[model samples]
Target: MKTNFQKNKIVEHPKESLAPKSGDKKDYTQSEFEEFIIKSGAVGSYMIFRSENEEDEMGISEL
Candidate 1:
């Protein structure tokens, strides 16, 4: 018996966050991000925004 090691495979790395300013926000959750992906059938990219609330609420949305 011979083993075939010539098969091509792709390895994808975990997505990385952009700048720190966006990450600091705390309103948006991962589920929302995933929902957007599922509803839209795809998510090319996304971004975070800090609202002008007294407590400075933050959330994630499509970029």
Candidate 2:
């Protein structure tokens, strides 16, 4: 038996209010990000977002 260990970097997603000052004021929510990942059909994709004090993670569906 063999085991493989690989480390990967996680990219953080931008929150609505965290957008740049010059950026649009559109509301960015969790669902919107999820939709984008789903529509793009990306595999092994995850999102990182900050809320309150802790970081979060979300994955796309395998459908």
Candidate number achieving the greatest lDDT relative to the actual structure: 1
In candidate 1, where is summed lDDT lowest over 10 consecutive residues? 54-63
- TM-scores of the candidates are 0.28, 0.26
Specify the poorest-scoring 10-residue window by lDDT in model 2: 54-63
How far residue 15's Cα lies from its native spot in candidate 2, in Å, is 19
For 1-63, candidate 2 gives per-residue lDDT tens digits of 235687558879676555467766766788998899799876454445545634323433562
lDDT value, candidate 2, whole model: 0.63
Candidates' C-alpha lDDT = 0.66, 0.63
Q: Write the per-residue lDDT of candidate 1 for residues 1-63, one digit (tens) a residue.
A: 246878668788679855667557765799998899799877445544466763445434543
Candidate 1: count of backbone clashes, pairs at least 3 residues apart or interchain: 0
TM-score of 1: 0.28
